[model samples]
Each structure stands twice: as structure tokens, then as C-alpha cells.
Target: MRCQPRYKGLVYIWLKNKQSCLLCNEPADGTAPICMACETELPWLGDHCETCALPLPAAGLTCGQCLKQPPRFETVIAPWTYGFPVDSLITRFKHSAKWPFGRLLAELLAQFLQHRFDEALERPDALVPVPLALKRLRQRGFNQAAMLARWLGASLDIPCEEQLLKRIHDTSAQQDLKAEARRKNLRNAFALAPDAPIKGRHLALVDDVLTTGATAQALARLLMEAGAARVDVYCLARTPKPGDAT
Candidate 1:
């Protein structure tokens, strides 16, 4: 987690001035291909729950659900709430193979995480992407979480362990399920790779979004049971409670 900043700093400096904004085609103003105006207009997450990163009115407060039944992961870190152009961008990136949009989001997420690392948030020893099932992977051609993880790992200099987890079976798509059904859908859905070096090592799960967190919880619990010291989630965005508009 403790990295020499000069190398990444230089890389970002090069990234900042190299290309036009992907969103507006204007000059990029920061560390990614996004203009200053468009960047500000993105749905940046405000203060939220300490555990799940759920959007909330106040800071330093855990949401009620986490209080009642604690999650296996230590925390969730997401830069934006799922809405607006963020949602549209992720949709296109995931479904339409718009790699640039995904790359742009991943770069910005790396910047957001770098600030957190500077502020002394403990960095994970490795990034473990949430794996897609074989059927879905065959159809999609690529795993969005794996792509995000690789980009983040390259930018942040963290090791990406793409094979640490595997989806054991395919299930109904989570987006179509309610919170309770989401949990049920993920039951027995994942497994740790044999001989994975998880013991006592902090690991972060990388994904595109944190919805009900059912997927994260199942995977994190598996890792923790496998002797992982801690687990955290890193994602592009977090959705508000179901049926709530942000």
C-alpha cells in the first residue's frame, strides 16, 4: 500500500495533458480524459455509510442494515453514486464494449483511491476481481471487473490476482433481483481458487458497481473463511437503496 509516489505522479502528469476529454472532446483538465466541467457534473458520491458506502445525508454513520447484520468486508470505496452519465457510461462500457469509457472511469477511480491511500487508508496487498461465470463470460467476451482491476492495478501499482476467485455456477442476473432475492441468487455462486495465497493477506475485490452488495458479501465471506486477514471492495459507483432516487 505504501508506494513511492514519484513514478505514478509522473505517469498521471503525462496522462493529464495527452488526450482530449472522452466525454466532451474538450481538453482534459486532470489526470484522466475528462474535462473540468464534465468532471464536476459527474454524480460524485457525497457523505455516506461507513461500511457499505451507501449514500446518506450525514457522514461517519453506519447504515441500519450493516448495524443489524455486519458484512464480511471491512469497507466499500466507491467514487460516485450510480446515476446520470456515470450509469450511462458504465452501461455502454459493459454492454457495448466501449472500452474507453470504462478506462476513463477506471483512471478516475485510481485517482480517487490514490487520495485515499495518501490519507492513510490501508492499501490492500492485492486486487482480486469479482469473476464472471463461464456462461456470461462466453457471451460478454470480457469481464468488466477484471478489466477494471487490471487498469487500477497498473495505475496504482497493486498486484492484480485475477485467478484468486472463480464463479462456481451461473445464476440469474443480479440486476433483475430484489435485495433478498439477490442474496439467494448468489448462494453457492463463488469459490476461492485452490492453493490461493489468501492467509493473513489483505485483499480488495474490484468491480464496476456495488448494488445490494450480495455478490461482494458472498465472495468476501469465502475469502475470510479461507484465512484472508481482511477484505474490502473497490468499485466505480454505488447505488442507493432500492426504489430510492439519488
Candidate 2:
């Protein structure tokens, strides 16, 4: 599947593999690349709060909660809410054993960042993916967040420190906990590198999604305490409060 340039020389290719398309085949004539249908389904985020990245309610300012109490992480940039095609897209890539979408999702994030912060990209820095507990990694077979970080690092030409932050404690599913309870659940769950210092350096903390943000808060605290000059969160999605899943 591919979208010919609006005029010419654009040529979008392989929305996915041809095999996954209704037409069917492995390479599926990527001459254009992503098919027209797949192209339309590409999840994109429009003008949104630069802080939380949550869709603002028409005239509201800073989503109320954020204005009251900003998250510990400096900023969040997510291309889509944790729903629909974005949800299915992540599941396919993480659980269904498909790996290509990881890069696709990272590209979408990069596009969003470029649109919002073209000048910020020139700042050389490190990307540290939220680490997973050894127990969870053993159970799930992969850390989707880490994989997403790797993909983003490659596309953005930034370095992903990969193992700077450590999950000091194994936490239960934060999804089931209340926002306040989530803070307690994730308390002391993370730690900075023993001697590795990111002091006076900018760090982009990557994760698949932001939920109660308790885990993110915990990580931000650790990084700051470890002497990080600043920390910004970059998640793929944000799960709305109550009944939302990412």
C-alpha cells in the first residue's frame, strides 16, 4: 500500500506488509509503500496540551488537574490516546509478535515532536526507557516500553542509555489501583544508576503510555534526586482516568 506523492516523488510504501493487506503478499509492491487504506488509519494527534498531551476540553485550561498539580516529568508528547487503532496497533506489535509497528509508532512520535519542537531536536541527549522488573520481563518475554525507546532513539538519532534506570521493586498492575494509591504502589520502585550520573544533562524518559502517572512520577523523582538537570516524558499514549485501558 502506498500513497503517491500529492504530486509526485512522495511515494508512501507498505502501510504494512502486503501479506497483511486484503491484497496479500510479503513485500506487496512497496513501490508506493503503505496502501491507501492503511495510510488513512495512521493514528495522528492534533493540537493538544503540550504538558499532558491529553485532548483539551474545548475551552479548558491545562486539563484542570495539570494546572492544579503538574506531573513530576516536565512534558509529555503522545501521538494518540490509548484507544482504537492505537491500542490495537500496540497490542499487535507487543503481544502479537509483530515488530515493524514499533518503528512505525516511533516515526509517528518523531513527527509529533518535530512539529512541536523542531529546535529542541538539535540538543544532544540521552533517552532512558522506563525499565521493567526482571520478573515481568521474564513473564512477558519483552519490555514493550524498552523496544519503543530503542526504535525512537534510532529514528531520532539520539542515544538510548538503555540501562540507566533500574526497577528496584516489582510492582503489581497499576491499572487496578486508584490514582493516589498508584503513588504508594510505585513508591521506591525505581532507582538511578549507582555511579552513572546524568547530572546537568537533559534526559527523555520513554514509555508506552501514561496512566495514573504514578510510575512516571516515581521515575522522575529518582532521576532528579540522582542529579539530573531535567527530565521530560515521552509516551505513546495516555489512558484516561477510570475504565480506560492502555
Candidate 3:
């Protein structure tokens, strides 16, 4: 969450020069393999509302909505915003079935969590991916979030239990809905699996992106109600947007 900008700034400086004499082949401007010129521009969450990490009323910590009803997940760390290259990358992996990213993101997410939450992340006993319903899994071919969880857990040497939680309902895409609608759409969407158990465990919930955070909140409540001691959210990106309190 508080990282001193790294080689990226230097990379950007090289990119702005537009010289054919590039030093590294890293994707020009991104957190990738090309030089700075080729990297996709990423939006950083600066001066954001602390509650939901959304760009605020150009002011304070907690946004008005978070003050009214806070989300259930304890702490969140999303390294980047869900847009441009990151968005397209997620789509490529999530929709186009790029499976290798599963492992790559896992390590990256673990590193970010270590940075963002530090000791807090070290406390989670397990990493659980937000589950996908049966129908969606059949359609999408793979659960990208689940892949991330496994990879992250392996990187941290923590166990990953894929069956701990599940989506019992199939809901419409939250990307297409308003904030209130997204919350309503996700209500009762998740249910704990009968065979899976999580009593007395501190769980780190992993997801690719969090927008309204409705799904994570709902799942966090269910997990606590089922006996989880602590729950932290670890996402690749958190969408920032304007909102009416939901």
C-alpha cells in the first residue's frame, strides 16, 4: 500500500524519450517484460477514501457509504486499478483461458499482500478464492481466482483449500450493474460447502478484481458466521468509481 515507486519511474523516463535505442526488452511502460514505451498506462489509487479505497469526495478517509455500512472483509490490498492493460490482462486470463497467469498472479498477489498488510498477511492460515458457480465454471472453463489462490498459497507456503466456500447461485455480471443493484445481485449468492470446514482459521480471500465489493462482503459475513476468526481481502485490482451509498 505504501511502496516507494520502483524502477517504474526510471522506465517511464526512458519511454517518454521515444528513442529506438531501448535498454531492456520489457514491455515499454507496464509492470511487464517490455521497455517503458510499450507498457500500458495504469491508474494508481491516490488520495482515496480509506473505507473502500475509492477516489473520495476529494477529501477524507472513510467515504460516506463506508461510514454508513462498512464492508465485512477486514483489510484490502489491490495493487492496481482494474482498467486498461490490467483489465485486458484479466479478460485474457479470465475469459480467454490464459492459465499461466494463475501462478504469476499468485506470487505477485502474495508479494503485494506482504507489502500492503505485512504482518497481517503472514497471519492468515489459508488462502481462499471467491468461488464461481457451476454454470459459470462450465462456461468460463476455469476459475481464475481459484488459480490465483492456489498459486499464492503455494508461494507463501500456506495451504489452499479450494472447496472451503462456494457460489450457490448464478448471478448476472456486476460489471453491468449499478452499486445498489450489484449488492442485491450478490445477495445469497454464496454458501459454504458441506464437506469443507474453516473453523478457527484466519482466511485470506483472493479475487482478481473488486468493484462494489458486494460479493466479498457477503462472503466475509458468511465466513465469520461460519466461524472464521479473521478475513482479509487480497485482490489484483479494486475498481474506483462514483457511487450513491448502497
Candidate 4:
């Protein structure tokens, strides 16, 4: 049997029940939590490195760093450069337990991923969020990356595996460390679950932000050692190289 179309009035009422813009408090145009205007004003990563998604002077090219030594992950997909309101939103979401901001960011990232999937990007078999050390998880009461991953997984109908990667060390935070130090700190930091069957699987590592990328690299390396065929990094924002402005 063919289903009848909803009345125009009913559609409008349903739309009204959706969320409004968290930044400007304007009614969102569609499923997004932010209005179109605010979305346009976001620090969109226009031109970036094809491999790392680092902001570049031009698009469709690899950055020198990637050419010198490629990262473990194949490609990075981030919609925004870590700047302005994006950084502020992430800080609040991660530090202050502001779940609404996190949800808004995750919704936007999911939309971007959907577009990529539509445009011939290969979908991953599962999403594994970069795990937090037990100490940090207890301190924060939640893992921000896990929350974002679960939200995106539900939106995109992909499996979210929180226990696929385990953090075995309580390393110092990466924020204040130099790039080399960050890499060193994350070395041997992540371990794959012994019983997880990941052979030949294409996996996407979900995280809130990509800074120096040390965490993602560590996790990706672990997945590769476990016989995973490919690893892709997915995050909301990517920060410019250390000491470089966005």
C-alpha cells in the first residue's frame, strides 16, 4: 500500500519541534542545530592538506610534512579548522560537561561524513573512538570522543566500538607538548582488544579534534598491526601546525 503524504501544516509542526541554533538562537533551517548563516560563518577548512586536513594555501595537494613522513591513517576528514567558536565550543564540551554543544558539533560532522560517503568515499566497517585512560575517564566522568562516535554511528547507521581500542597508559595531556614530545608520549599508548576480529576491516577513528595527531597515529598503528586493512581519521576540527595561525 502507498503511504499518504503528510499535510503541509503537519510538516511545519514537526519541523518546529526540532532544535534551534545554539549560537544565535535562531530557528534551524533543517536538522542542523545551527542556522545556515552561522554555519557559513564557521571556520570551515577550505583549503587543506589531502592527507592530514591541515589548512593549506591551496587545495588538492599534500602538505610537506605528509610527503616527508606519511601518517598511519590514510586520510583525515574534518569540516572545520580549530579556531574561533569551534575551539571554544569544543573546550566547553570537553571540559564543562556541556553536552548540547557536543551534540551540535557531532550532528554537523555527521552531515559532512554523509556528503563524503555520497561522493564515492569508502565507508568504514566500524568506528573506534580514541580511548581515554582509566584515570582520565574517571576524572571527567565520560569520554568525549566516545560520545561523539556513538552519536555519529547512530546517525550514519555504522557500528560504534568503544572497546576496540584500549588506552593502557595515563600519559600526560598532549596540549602543552611539542609535536615530537606528543608523538613520544603517545608511543605504545594504545592497544587493540585481543578478541576483536578486525582483520581486513576498514575502520575510522573518531575524535573530537585533531591537534598534533599523535593520539590518532598511535591508535591507527595499533589497528594496522591487528590486520585492519585501512584506517581513516574523522574529527570535527583540525588545528593548524604548532605556532602557526589558522
Worst 10 residues of 2 by lDDT: 19-28
Candidate No. with top lDDT: 1
List candidate 4 segments past 4 Å from native: 1-16
**TM-score: model 2 vs. ground truth:** 0.79
| lDDT, model 4 | 0.89
Predicted candidate 1 versus true structure: per-residue lDDT over 1-246, tens digit per residue: 868544431122334447677777887866577888999999999989999999988989999999999999999999999999999999999999878889989989999999999999999999999999999999999999999999999999999999999999999999999999999999999988889999999999999999999999999999999999999999999999877777
How much lDDT does each candidate structure score? Answer: 0.93, 0.70, 0.71, 0.89
Range of the 10 consecutive residues with the lowest summed lDDT in candidate 4: 7-16
Off by over 4 Å in 1: 1-16
> Which has the higher lDDT value, candidate number 1 or candidate number 3?
1
- TM-score, per-candidate, Cα-based: 0.93, 0.79, 0.77, 0.92
How does candidate 2 score on lDDT?
Answer: 0.70
Q: Which pairs clash in the backbone of model 4?
A: none
**Better candidate by TM-score, 3 or 4:** 4
RMSD of 4: 7.4
lDDT of candidate 3 over 1-246, digit per residue (tens): 968845443322322424221223333333323343433244544566665666654746777777898777777667677666667667777887755344444555666666755644446888889999899899988888888887777666778888988898899987899879998998888989895677878887888988888888899999999988888888887777744321
Give the 10-residue window scoring lowest on summed lDDT in candidate 1: 5-14
Local lDDT at 148 for model 2 = 82
Kindly state the number of residue pairs that clash in model 4.
0
How many clashing pairs per prediction, in order?
A: 0, 13, 15, 0
lDDT of 4 at 2: 62
